[model samples]
Target: MAYTFEILETEKIELVIPLVYKLNNGKIDKAVLMERFSDMITYNNYECAVIYDGSKLIGVTGLWFCTRHYSGKSVEPDHVFIDENYRGKGLGKQFFEWIYNYVKDKGCEAVELNTYVSNAASHKFYFNEDFKILGFHFLKKLKK
Candidate 1:
């Protein structure tokens, strides 16, 4: 199978939102996500990379570039997902390799990502890719 990877253009982002929702377990409404994601792409330093097999979109990951005291220039890839029908075929590995090269090209000092704690398979995969458990990630939501 021929695979192609490209940075998705702003106008073409909707094509991957379904997979994004799937990654979030469909908890967030699409309209809300669309609006927020559009705003993010418009106002933030974020970009998405998509992998396609021929004409089919097979995977997507959102990359956010930032500078931290520990890592200097870093790229935190979020919303990583591979189509259900396309998983376990080594595509995720290929996608991450693409991400590493992409980050390196951007002169990033490191690449970091957070996966849900309950996702053991992803934990194993990430470990195999040499990602370590740096520390705990905490969050607190404020009421509007």
Candidate 2:
């Protein structure tokens, strides 16, 4: 199977949104997706890449470039998603390798991403890809 990574554009937003919604397990609302798409278009310091099998969008991944006083410099993978049908076909690894190489070429010292503790499969994949677990991530939910 052949795969290609294309730089995401506003024209492909519709196709990308559904895959992202599926990856997030339907937790994200359409409104939020639209808002984020707008933000992605307006933000010049970030990069978004989508994987395609022929003409169909199958995966999406990206990172925001930023520098912090305490953390120094780093790039964070905002969202990484592979379509259910494409999972386990070695596409996820390709996505991460591409992201790592892209970030390294852009002079980022490190890349970071967060996944829920319950996602054991993801944990194994990340570990196999050589991503070290630094520590725990604590979250505080705000009542709406």
State which candidate has the highest TM-score.
Answer: 1
Model 2, range 45-118, lDDT digits (tens) per residue?
77678898999888887678887664557888766788888888888898888877877888888777787777
Off by over 4 Å in 2: 68-72
| Candidate 1: residue pairs that collide | none
Question: What lDDT is reached at residue 20 by model 1?
Answer: 87
Q: Give the root-mean-square deviation of each candidate in angstroms.
A: 1.0, 2.1
lDDT against true structure, model 2: 0.80
TM-scores, each model vs. reference: 0.95, 0.86
Q: Residue by residue across 14-60, what tens digits does model 1's lDDT show?
A: 88889889988999999988987888788577999999989888889
